[model samples]
Target: MRRASSLIAYAIACCLGWPAQAQDYPAHPIRIIVPTQAGGVSDILSRTFANKVQNATGATVVVENRTGANGVLAADYVAKSTPDGYTVYLGFQGTQSVLPHVEPKLPYDPTRDFAPVVLLATGPAVLVVHPSMPARSVKELVELAKAKPGAYSYASAGFGTTHHLAAEMFKLAAGVDLTGVTYRGAAPANQDVIAGHVPIEFDNLGLAVNNIRSGAVRPLAITAKDRSPLLPDVPTMAEAGYPSVIAQSWFAFFVPAKTPRPAIDWLNRQANEVFSDPAMRDQFLRQGLVLPLGSPEFLGQHVAEETQRWGEVIRKAKITLPN
Candidate 1:
């Protein structure tokens, strides 16, 4: 009886300690899933995090781009993955906000299907214009658009993308109608704007920063509440007298659903640590990423807010996409 009781105690201890043992967390190479193709902002940020995490923890971090369906494919993949913290997702505003509004049959719920890790960045869009637009300020641009409603056209990366919705909001707030031309990705949209084929676009800061600096495009306003440090003289839409017009993109990390809180917390702490490092902060800023971050709770709140906010925009704009 004594021997049997001792054996039972040993078994119980192992069972209880199973998760703790696995708390070495990423025992093998981990995957950082970027829902878009390589070279996009989300992909770039995910790679940065992957490299930093690999250096900090000695765990091999691989960035896997699973692009399609405006991120539904990759998001669904991550949603159904094991809750063992081995698979991490890099999510952006499109997946969290626009996709849900545009497509009602999403396979996974953004808030419920994943464990929110930490916000990666809140990169604002810049109001980029062709070189010959003759609008150097937000007021001037509004005047120009007002003078010729629907004459000035803008190109966006896609239908229902944050860039498109932001442009829609800007049109409503500025009381001007700019024809929207959709493209497959930022590269083509930005290309048309730079070549003066389209007169205006509100492009993601990271995507347009180099071109804006190189005179490929001109920036009039940044779509944040405050002007971007990179564009010091540019006014925010709200600051430029358009309070209801704000378009910003937020990127976040997530683990599969039901992941242990400890694992999620640890990843969040690691991300916060990375964000607080001045070197990382400066490097990200140079990459056109702004740190607007906090705990997983903050990401949860952000998801809720943006989901509702973009929903309203889509409804009012009566926006629909083409196949």
Candidate 2:
């Protein structure tokens, strides 16, 4: 009878302790995993957010770069981790939405394997061309490409990358046959475009801004519905008559699917607090990331919608990666 009473007491204690465990989240160091290399936009964003979280809560937060298989490796690591919220994923649109449609046999299901925390930000791509190219505007570039089908080749980060998909969208929308020259990543692709080896390319606004400002590449159009304040002069793809070619890269935070709701709530509250600061908001704006801060539900809904959108694009473009 005494042993039974003790067992009942222990069960009650465990039930009561659940809330405490959730409240004491980050009792240890939290690690934010970036799927790309250090110094890229993902790396910088993760580090900045980590620093903010650390400063705000006195938590020992750290950012780690687990680069491989175009973010699949890092994502898989986070998906399989213990659902304690210590291991966080800094996921972006490409890996979370686009990859599912492209990779035939993904190790982890993006929509199923993770729980959404928050939608961080979104940045659009810019259509750029070599300075010496006669095509100045989006129309002129389309005219040139249409005039000589398959004659012009654009540089892309890789086969299934955002820029590559943008180029494919452009091809479908403009009825042009511009060849795609694939590079390992955006830096080398942008380098080739700047060197005039490739005449045209679509690149991220943040990474393409400095080169555009320096006149290394001429800006033609932005793949957004509205113009960015940083490049007010640049017209939108819709304005340029290609309303169908809008593509924006987004970033968000996610934890493993079974992570406790309290931990997710705490992380969401922290991110919303840190990023909603006006100074921080303006800082991201200047860097070309438009914050879309909201509840975890918002992130989940947005990811679902984006997954559908990108899946359609991938199907139309027939994009696939090797298993």
Write model 1 residue lDDT over 1-323, tens digit each, in one string.
Answer: 99999999999997787678567776777788898878877887788777888889887889999988878899999999989777889988888778777777889988788888888898888888898989888899889988988889999988877678899998877788899999987889988888899989989887788898899998887888777778787778877788778788888999898987767886787778767888878888886788876999888888888889898988888877676
Model 1: lDDT to the true structure? 0.84
- lDDT, residue 52, model 1: 83
Q: Provide TM-scores for the models.
A: 0.89, 0.92
Q: 280-300, model 2: which lDDT tens digit per residue?
A: 989988888898989999999
| lDDT score at residue 276, model 2, on the 0-100 scale | 91
Instruction: Give per-model CA RMSD.
Output: 3.8, 2.8
